[model samples]
Target: MIQQSLVLTGKQKLAWLENEVRDLKDDELLICTIAGAISIGAELPQYNETDVTDCNPVYPRETGYESYGQIIRMGKEVTGFAEGDRVLAFYGHKNLGVVKANKTVKVPDDVEYRYALLNTLSCDAAKGVLKLQPQRDDKVLVTGAGTIGLLTVHFLKNYMNVKHIDVLEPNDKRRELAHELGASHTYSKKEQISSTYYDYGLECSASKDAFHSVLNSMKHHGEVCILSDGNKDLFYLTEDFYEKELKIVASSDGWDYQKHSQWFFKETVKVPQLSKIFEAEITSDQLIHCFEELSESHNKPLKVLVRYL
Candidate 1:
């Protein structure tokens, strides 16, 4: 059976590769009919390559780390999940692929596939928000209104009981979206920095300047959660950080659903308002177009999904 999968050939270039589907091994599950795309670290510009001399032609590597689909086939060793179950996994955007059963999480029957696609992101946002240990009265500042940033805001307001939330985003659409998602105030980069000192800061943008802005606006002993990944060397330590004894916490890649009791995906889906964040949806064949749309800096789409037919 030939299956079509999207692969990144070079910087800003995507192509569909058709290949024969392989059978699932024991302890593995075969996913089919993928629902949405999750922009993992692979989509970042830093991973793109200018030189492609040594790159493979037929199976040019694919980017992205999370996707959702139905389990069409399960190995004999797979006990918890049966065929026809909707599951989310730490896998790339592919029509059909085999993954270890342990890496996949079953989606509830009531939860829509669009929300299920955000499971990995929800877990990441929840992890970062939990690490901050926000207080009910803490003045929170979130830098960046991207998907992770928005999810952080949602978790802070809905779960952490944080009020007086402020979001910093340059894009007008995203700033408005942030306000709708629970941000008490939203500001562009050129706007005058707020006089109110934030007790907690969530750094969700990759820009070093934004990081500095959040750091400067924080109060003494304030804790800031660094959620985005990029060139970190650009961020320098300053006198304010030392004088205030501020704490900067880095959250990344270490989420295990089996070990922890928190069900981030389940909890996030329960919030009906979050569904509004899915800004764009495209079929699997339009994967390249979706990437092109997301590549534009000014286009502030919160979430883009690639639905499989």
Candidate 2:
């Protein structure tokens, strides 16, 4: 079987690679993708070649991890899932791929493919939220209005019943979207955050300044859960972190996909507009062009959803 994939040939470079698919392992499922999502925080740095987390850049690498598809074939050992069942997996932006049966989550029939793509990040947000264990009355602050940040806000306000959820973001459009998504306040500058004290904070901006801002806004001994990939820059401990004796915990990927899906899939129905987080939608064929547009500063969208046939 031949598969076409989006590959990063070099900095600001993209190409389609046609390759042969390997035989499916007994524990794997063959998925025919319906759509995928580009995580701006995680992938953009690599795409723009600003990611310094690695000593050097590696070319001809795959670039995405969020995708939803139907199971075209399932291994005999796979029991819970079957052929034609829709699921969300960690596969990249491609028409078809093989994924481990355990790592995939079954998408509810009522959930749209575009919305199901969020399963991964939403689970990540839920993990971070669960780590901190914020209460309904606890004032929480989220730094960044990206998909992860906004999802953090959405989970806090809607699911967790957090009353005062404030967001800090530099972009006007994102800040406004944050407000619509149930943020009590949106601040673009640090000055606006002077008097606010939060019981907990979730850092999703992956910006050094934003990380520090989250630390600075916390109350004494306040806890913080970092959801950002932080690929482009290193985060250092700030004075507030030391002085306040803050507790910071970092989380990446979902803690439990199957368990979280039970709650998230149902939540999607109640919050139908939550899919609005994806401001732009493109077909799988436009992936290269989509990344090209994303490389530009002015072309930033909350998130881009890629639809595949």
Q: Write the per-residue lDDT of candidate 1 for residues 1-309, one digit (tens) a residue.
A: 676677777667778788897877899998886676746333645234422223433335676676778888888889999888988776677778779999878877777777766666766877887888888898999988888888788878877878889999888888887887789999897245663298888888877788888878888998988888643324666666887789998898546653321455556546766776787777777777666765665554567677787
What is candidate 1's CA lDDT for residue 76?
88
Q: What's the C-alpha lDDT at position 158 in model 1?
A: 74
- In model 1, what lDDT does residue 203 have? 85
The superposed Cα distance between candidate 2 and the true structure at residue 117, in angstroms, equals 0.6
Best by lDDT: 2
In model 1, what is the error at residue 205, expressed in angstroms?
1.0
- In order of appearance, the predictions have TM-scores of 0.86, 0.95
TM-score of model 2 vs. true structure: 0.95
Error of 1 at 141 (Å): 1.0
lDDT of 2 by residue, 1-309 (tens): 788888889888888888888888889999998889888778888888787686588777887999898999888888898799999888797888899999889997878987788878888998999999999999999999989998898889877999999999988988988898799999998778953399999999888888888888999999999888878669999889889999999887788988988888888888776788888888988988888888886658788888887
Backbone atom clashes (below 3 Å) for every candidate: 0, 0
